[model samples]
Target: MTPPVIETRALAIGHGRQPLGRDIAFSLAAGEVLCLLGPNGSGKTTFFRTLLGLLPVLAGEVRVCGEAVAGWSRAAFARQVGYVPQAHAGVFPFTVAEVVLMGRLARIGRFSAPSRQDRDIAADCLDMLGILPLHDRVYTAISGGERQLVLIARALAQQPALLVMDEPTASLDFGNQIRVLDHIGRLRGQGMAVLMSTHQPEHALRVADRIALFNAGQVIADGPPAAMITPARLASLYGVSESAVSASLSPLLSPERNVLP
Candidate 1:
């Protein structure tokens, strides 16, 4: 059987001498979307950075494609893992196509220019995100939501086996949020593994094959959405009352009345 695209065993993360999360464990396989749900400041971003080897692990190990992540060179890792971080403006006013084309850097030679094939892949990625028209727009001039989509397109251009996205829908409007989630589902069907952090439980229910609840610096629960997204679980994770959770979720997710009256 093929090994998981990413795996963590007894992992610990932190900054310098401080610790954020420990004993972290999970594995994401090909064709799966694993959603991380947590409150703000819950260390989800820290965990992602550790997995990508941006920060040193305090303990344990992170493995990608059956090899230790710490052992892989930066270029080798980029060839395997694509990252979509929170959207922000670039220092320079690069065109959207130029920004997406940067993803091809890992595959290109040190001194060579981007090839026709690379440009084609970047354009295809932009088209995939329904943002082909933004190709000529200035990255710094677009709206935040548009920038977010452009970042996703850039990551897709990498054509990596695994994608690690931090709050992919953060700046998106509702329609675009759904579009991104639906595209995530499609990516799974195409045999890519995705590890994304989101604050929206409803989004996880829609797209994730498994949900991991991060709270107080640990994975409090990891399971199927049906089993993990109950009123009690969400309430505890967010420090809200269970009754409130039920009241808010029932009208949307309840079997009898999924539509609001």
Candidate 2:
């Protein structure tokens, strides 16, 4: 069997003397998209942080691209894993291209300028997200959707083997959400592994090759979307009525609506 791109063995994630969830064991293969579904404050962020080595693993192991994450050098890990955090307050007025170019910092030495090739990669990423025209616009001045695309582009510029995103499309319009998710789907097709956390099950059912339902601090269910997204599993995860989950997600399973809102 081919080794997985990412693997977590009995991982226990938490913060400040509190364990948010149970032990987790899973592996994500190349060209796969794994969507994490959970209610707010269900330790999704903690899990993401743990995977990125931002938070210490209380127990167990995390391996990325066949090496223990804790054992890898910071620069080497950064090149292998690209992370896109939730929207943040931007104080700098840098242009969109400038913001995206920052992802290349690890590849370039301090105080060294970006080469033409670096600029080209950034521009290509912008074009991939259909935001090439916004390259010259100030990052702070652009709309939320545009900012989201720029952040994604920045992550792509890292040329990572795995992309991890926290709520990549939490506050976007319907059209923009589809656009962003579609772009993510394309990346998986091109052989990049993606793991993203989202509250919207409909979105997960549409774009995710696999779904992992997290509750209380651990993944209660993990499988292909068709197996894990049933009404029974979703209801238990969200503590909602089964009928409601069925009703809200039925449309998502339709072929016509799978790619759009």
lDDT against the true structure, each candidate: 0.91, 0.88
Q: Tell me the tens digit of each residue's lDDT in model 2 across 1-261.
A: 778999999888899767776579888999999999998878899999999999989899999878788888777888889998988547899999999998888787558999999999999999988899999999999987778878989999998899999999986788878888998888898899999999887788778999999877888888998898888988988889999988887777767766444
- Candidate 2 stretches with Cα past 4 Å from truth are 254-261
Residue 123 CA displacement from its true place in model 2, Å: 0.4
Please give the TM-score that candidate 1 achieves against the real structure.
0.96
**Model 1, runs deviating above 4 Å:** 259-261
Write the residue-wise lDDT of candidate 1 on 78-172 in tens digits.
99999999777788989999999988888995688999999999999999889999999999999999999999998898889999999999899
Candidate 2: worst-modelled 10 consecutive residues by lDDT? 252-261
| lDDT (C-alpha) at residue 155 in model 2 | 94
Local lDDT at 256 for model 1: 87
